[model samples]
Target: MTGIEAINVYCGLARLPVPALFAGRGLDPARLDHLMMTERSVGLPCEDPVSNAVNAARPVVDALSPEERDSIELLVTSSESGIDYSKSIASYVHAYLGLGRNCRVMEVKQACYAATGVLQLAAGYLASGVSPGARALVIATDVSMADARAGYAEPATGHGAAALLIGPDARVLELDPGAFGLYSYETLDSARPEPDRDIADVDASLFAYLDCLSRSFADYRSRVADADWHTTFTRLALHTPFAGLVKAGHRKLTRELTGAGPDAVAADFAERVAPSLHYPSRVGNLCSGSVYLALCSLIDHLPPGAPPQRIGLFSYGSGCASEFFSGLVGEGARQALAPARIGERLAARVPIGFDEYTDLLAGNSRCLLPVADRDIDLAPYERFLTADPGRGRLLVHRGTKNYHRTYEWV
Candidate 1:
């Protein structure tokens, strides 16, 4: 079965510590302690989803040999942070990465579940025997911002991206063929129909998440009924909106799957599930990328010389689709990941004051322009400000009438 051959992730450079954010908003200090105890760290932000996807995928593509890069037959981008109403974000990413034009490019949006959907689709495409020796690139990139006016969700919101290179030969995790379960239904627990804001029924969203988790997991168990629930998978990764919710989900899963009492469940979770939370605790919610980010965390923090393990993955998106799947942690998986290096990079991020974050939210110094302006020097735009001139990458305006955009590598 086609599975992840290589994986890379990127978090925003700007870090907003939870305590500082609370202090900035004059929130109670007790709440700060609560967040800290739960291991919440900071949030990251990028100029746009395009940049996030590009930076996340660049390293993985660079690691590839020229022949492997040439063999990429599909590019599927998953996100709700889409810039254009019509054009697929995959097209921008395809050009930015200098991938061949002879590839299929499309965007998937089922809220946060889109990434899982596209991953399955990519696996099916590769397994179809339609294109021998071909590969697919699946990218999950999102930047979720909370409205300062709507203050409650700010602490839970975050931004980041993850890219997975899937093919027949996997050095990382090998996906099990016909070993996935999905449950989807229409619901308005969370939504962002408008560009600038998101609306959610918090209680309803939590209920939906747990419900979907239970149902999808049940479907998974039915498929592998003889498998031992308590000892089958060595690690559990769930879509994390916050550390607390994931804890709750773990407890629920333990009860339903293993019939373990509270004490036993807590013990099992501390050993098996907590390791997966290490990265998400620091990066906040990555929307479509959250579950995959958790998977990355699991690989990054694995112990030395540990035997291969089965990792269970649970993904849920609000408005709302869910899935449960498992992947085998093949040998040499740990050698391919550099969790310590990623931690060091995250440590070097510049922390912003509460005022700066609010200012950014307010668009005070944000580099945005009107749609009618025909003559835009894209080089100076803040979105492209971080582009390395030496790297020969530049953003070019394709057309002014519709803000048609593309990138160039000179």
Candidate 2:
């Protein structure tokens, strides 16, 4: 009886067209047809991982009754963008959200899969009944380290966060008991060995993703009775590094499990998978939070007053950890998440051309650096900040003082 009670995302107030970025980087325009992404989020210098997490979770937290808010017994913040080695982003998120001090707070790493990893653990804890009525807040937030060096991935690498409130209520998604799979190994498909730099082997990453999708589902089938990839779930969400990757992964799995011809596969994808790609297509990859974004897209796409449905989910993180799991979305799921206004906020994001995006890279790159002291020149980013809809509640990083990160509400 434990699963996601609510979910929301903070995708920044700016966006860059993928074509604009491709042209700026001198990449082949033809590749856009394959990427399946129209735009990517652009993070301002004043915004960092901590702020992204807080901004995303604030609405969800504030919507809770005081009793419900105090019941949140755990907070886990997952991110690849770490500002300080010893400190976890949870510390900042916890303080900003004003959660109970008794809550268990920690951070995790494992590339994009980190959020799902911790989410499963949290669900188990809540279901154990030792702390009856306890809830957990899981936020997967990251800033893009992508630039010209990342090549095509640079355009797909988005910046934002997804926040989920997991509890016994489970209005949004209810966990299917003991129906899951896991796969992990060591391979350097992608890594951020140093701050402000990202290196990735696109080919290795893609292969690993598709490979994990197939194997994880197989493992899941072995555990669950009468599990059929084609019929077990009505809708599916795979980690979307880009929409095309999800399409490719779906094609691979659909082919193996059903042996469907290309035409059937295409029709199945358009119905079950394409709805999940809408957010990824707009905001690009959300790292650890990517799959959740896909899930949000899927739920939001549901017609109002639709019947309850089961959803299949796949999450793959790059130092290679992955899982395939199933959850039930209740009839009120979409209405429960409506307060977040994810789509409206995303549409409100101001569009930035190639020139402004190119200028942002330098400032955004410094986000993960462990510098002793610096001041963010928000003066240059006034437009992005001035008209923010969540102005007072939106947390933003001011800079660092003696290596101490500072943040203030916008």
Candidate 3:
């Protein structure tokens, strides 16, 4: 019996809604813009991607007082980029948030699918009754490919993060121990860059990636069938790759599941999914955070007094690892969501000019640049400059950075 036997997601942030930025700094109109024109690859809009990720998570953490953050048994941060391989993102986040040192910090690696894997692992521990009353903290965030010259290189790759505080509660989604599936294929043919490397050739574009996901689903469906599981999964929270990849995979999978005939399950699942794309279009692809973002988006729109919902999740990581899992969205999902407030925050962003975006991009993590004690009202906790770069160390800044920069929950 795990400490917290169920999982309930907090808020999910997709894009930095910079209406001002979008209006002022027109994005490259080309289907995909390679070779960024900005003096620096980093832009203010780019900053918002990460900032918004942290921003989207603020409310969830705020709902829990400092006491809860400190008590989490494990803090798992799954992402492609770590500030430095030697440093732990979980540790950095913990220090920034003033979480207790007692927290077990670890990062997962598996491309976009890493976050789901981490959640599954935590669920297993909980199911075993290992830490009967303990909980796990899972946060997934990713910024754009650092290279400004690549097929996937539009400022389109926005930054963001999603945090889910998992614990036992009869009110939330109950843990389905044997329900989820795990699968992977190994090869570096389509790998994202290592910290020392740059973006690699898109031997497989986003379209090709979707095709891989389709193939994975077909493969997994057969396994489920072989096991004599005849259950039907209705809704799905897909990993947003580019956009609409889910629909593409869904079409192919439903066709396979229903024998290529027009049917209610296939048609209804397609129509019901319109709202899931709301954040993906704006946020672009958040690497690991995509699946949870889609899940959170669905939770926001679900009607009151709705019956329990079963969702199938498809997670794929290039260098190719993919997995599918299922869950029941519990009855108490509504109150725990606080959905409307999150929608309001997403709507309030000011767009940035392309020029300003360039400026922000160039200045990201500027060691020599002066910074003042600015009030980051959207974040939940305090942020402070801990040390000066001159101390013979690679300059670093750290704080309890959650979904956003500060707390405006009051």
- The lDDT values for all models are 0.75, 0.92, 0.53
Higher-lDDT candidate of 2 and 3: 2
The most accurate candidate by lDDT is: 2
Candidate 2 yields a Cα-based lDDT of 0.92
Give the higher-TM-score candidate: 1 or 2.
Answer: 2
Deviation (Å) of 406 in candidate 1: 6.2
lDDT of 3 by residue, 1-410 (tens): 22122222212222233333333445443522232111111222213222333343444555566766555788888877555445556655665444678768877767778887888788777557766666777778655544345434344455556776677652435544565555555556455554423354455545445566566655655655542112455456788765545665666655655555557545655555645666555555667877776776676667788788666677878777777766677767656665424455344333434554544444443311223333323232111111122211111223224322222211
Badly placed stretches (over 4 Å) of model 2 are: 388-392
Clashes of each: 0, 1, 36
Clashing pairs in 2: 112-288
RMSD of candidates 1 onward, in order? 3.8, 1.0, 8.2
- Overlapping backbone residue pairs in candidate 3 total 36
Better of 2 and 3 by TM-score: 2
lDDT by residue (206-284, candidate 2, tens digit) is 9999989988888999999999998989999889999998998999989888999999999999999998999899999
In model 3, how large is the Cα lDDT of residue 125?
70
